[model samples]
Target chain A: MSPPAALRAAGLVKSYRRGRAVDGVDLTVALGERVALLGPNGAGKTTTLLMCLGAVTPDAGTVEILGHRLPRERSHALARVGFTAGYLPLPERMRVVEYLRLYARLAGLRRPDVAARAALDRFGVSHLARAMGTELSSGQKTLVGIAKAVLHRPALLVLDEPTASLDPDVALRVRTGLREISAELGTALLVTSHNMVEVERLCERVVFLSAGQVVANGTPAQIIDRYGHDDLEGVFLHLS
Target chain B: MPTIEVYHGAAASFWRVMAIARRHAYVLQRSPHRLFDIIVWPVVDVILFGTIGVFAAGRLGGAGQVALYLLVGVVLWHVVYQAQISLATGFLEETWSRTVLSLLVTPMREWEYVAGVALFGLVKLLGGVGAVALIAWAAYAFKITTLGWGLIPVAALLLAVGWAIALFVIGLVLRFGSGAEALAWGILFVVMPLSGTFYPVSALPAVLRPIGTLLPTTHAFAAGRAFAQGAATPWHELGLAAAGTAVMLALGFGYVVWMLRVFRARGFVTRYS
Candidate 1:
């Protein structure tokens, strides 16, 4: 039997008065599958992710996370999902450990200290645990943000531009961490990034979005083959 | 079973919010200079105003009477101003640090987030009020003994008004970006002189009185002054104030909801490119 889909959105329609941002988009991700959402700047990839996370409501469509609808049943859905975004940083006044502990508790961890420490260690930033969030470098902040999201070991992880500002070495560490988390916890991963090579290296499948629509969806190699491109970057540039 | 699950989840969310509040409070505690600034600014203003009144007693009202009046106005005005500005600045800090979007994606609803910010604002306002009241009592034996209980209702009204103003400003912040801070400051400066903070609304120029009446701060100041003087508050006027505050809050919240919709629709979430 196929594993249950960790997240599913059907006929998702989100529009502004001026134009549609996401036009009748449909997407699904099974447990433990790593899917990369690839799109240009205004392709509505983040809108789709925000809708799935229940941060933004779709004008028309249904979204289910772990088989639970959003906004109405969001508490149940969000409890099982973890998310990170380049646009959303942690509170600057908060210490790394304090912020992690707070989110860990929110994510339903009983002993938040242990969970926070473990997450920090996993990302190899335990030394910076007591530092203020504002004091950290961009790469260090990204690691802590990711640690905060995954402290409860969520079954579904949604990350947006997770490695956008990181050094290549730190980005590789994060990539390794994402793969390890998916493997160990059987967590489905849906991530959006500008780094096509990172997506090619880390994701099992890729979904290409253009002008608020999913223009292509398939395995990385299959998408490359279908688009007649040398690699994921070539395909992304062609579609974008 | 579903009910029990919801209960557990709500309890958990409440604890999480409380935890964030506690962390924030801890940070405030560590930064004693910030706390000192809140308290010290009011004291310095009181002294400066009191001195001016004393020196110009013949030109102004009786020195003692004018000092007492200004004390009430300054203390109450400070609370309203502090509450509004602090809440906006707090949210601005979150936006600057990119944490508002982070919290939005959590299980927390928009209402809960607003509640948390309002709660923090309330704490800050109360602290400032308490410090000012204490200093006034110590220095001048100032007492609003008969009107003490009225402070509660006045504070509640002012808090609602402040939160409403903050919400409207937050919508602008989310839409126009950090430039909203300058707008907020400008609005506050324009509103303060007309708010009857230093004098009665009757003292304003005939044309300005109508403008003053349009502000919630005018009603808040009237309510607070009545409470300070132990005057019988006109319930009709109090009701009108409350109603006006409620309308502002409702409109502010509605505006925020609409702005969020617009932000989503416009793809602001992914417009970094």
Candidate 2:
């Protein structure tokens, strides 16, 4: 028998009166696999991620994360899943350490401070622990956000444009640190990014989404080869 | 249909609720304005009305009882008003901070989260009411405790009414987004005039009297006035108020649950955009 996949989503459909956000989508990420989700704006990347995390209930679909069904067994499923997004900011009134500790506790860590500190140290943001969340620069906020996301060492870590708005140098550092952490912890990573460079650098496999559907799925090299393109960015343009 | 597997039993659920309460306490401890709103505003309202009652006693008939009457009404009304405000704003705060998505992605269930907010709001309400009662006694020589052990049940029923209103506001905000946040502070005041806080329910116009009787605060204040006049216990009024509160609570919880389902289905539960 095979080991259970970290994430399994099938026939996922979500629609607002505005229009269909996600339509008949199926996705899976193997344990310890790092996959990039690429799509243009309004392509349902955020909607799909929310459904997989059990943050949003799909109108018609099924999702299981770490072997637990969504919405029904969401509590169990959420315990092993971590998520970070540039769009979802932390509370400004809370200090960095306080914010991280809250999430650690919510994730059910026994000693939230210890887990929080480890995440801070790992992300090289330990010195900023006492600073208010509002005081941080854009890059600093992303670093703190990622540290909070990984504090409990979730089995599946999801990121939506994690490096969006950072300076190039800081973005590179975060990309490198996240890649190293995922490899060290053997955590399955599902990342969505518009930056093809980050995708090519961090992901082993790539899934391109367009118009609420998965348009292409393969390794970066395979995608570039299949699409007759020189790089991942060229492939994204061709597909999206 | 898939069945939900609850991770925590009763005990663990309590701890999760406490964690949320603790988070609010941390915020209150840090922000003076939040603390002031919870503690100072009610006391000021009591003093303001209490002073008016004192002055009116010298000038008009039946005015001597005004001080105690208004004091009791303001103090008790805070129990419900503050509770509703605190809990509704507690939920709204998450949306403003854009942290609702992060919270929903956790292992905590919806009921646990709501319970936590309500508990914290209750605690804040207790402190505010206690402060007002203390000040009323120390400064004016009026004793709210004179209402005796019956005050406990009265306060509980009022808090339940507050919880119901807060839940209803939360449901509205969840359905309509933060654009409806004004409902948190505004809804309570809409009911205040009809609640007969300063006047007896009989003083309301005949047409308004029927609507007034349906309000939990109406029965609470009536019982409070009877207690002030030395009624041993206003079981009749308390019983009716309790029944009214139960209905409001059921409606509030139903609205909250239904709105939450709408939020989830409409993809409003975790959108940061």
Q: What RMSD does each model have against the real structure? A: 4.1, 3.6
Ten-residue region with minimum lDDT total, candidate 2 chain B: B1-10
**What residue pairs clash in candidate 1, if any at all?**
A89-B98
lDDT of 1: 0.78
True-vs-predicted CA distance for residue B263, candidate 1, Å: 3.1
- Candidate 1 lDDT at A83 equals 91
Q: Per-candidate TM vs. native? A: 0.85, 0.95
TM-score of B-chain for each predicted structure, in order:
0.85, 0.93
- Enumerate the candidates' DockQ scores in order: 0.36, 0.43
Q: What is the per-residue lDDT of model 1 for residues A9-109, given as tens digits with 9 covering 90 to 100?
A: 99999887668889999999988889999999989998899889887779999998988887678877898899987656667678899898777766656
Those runs of model 2 whose alpha carbons end farther than 4 Å from true positions after fitting are A1-3, B1-12, B270-273
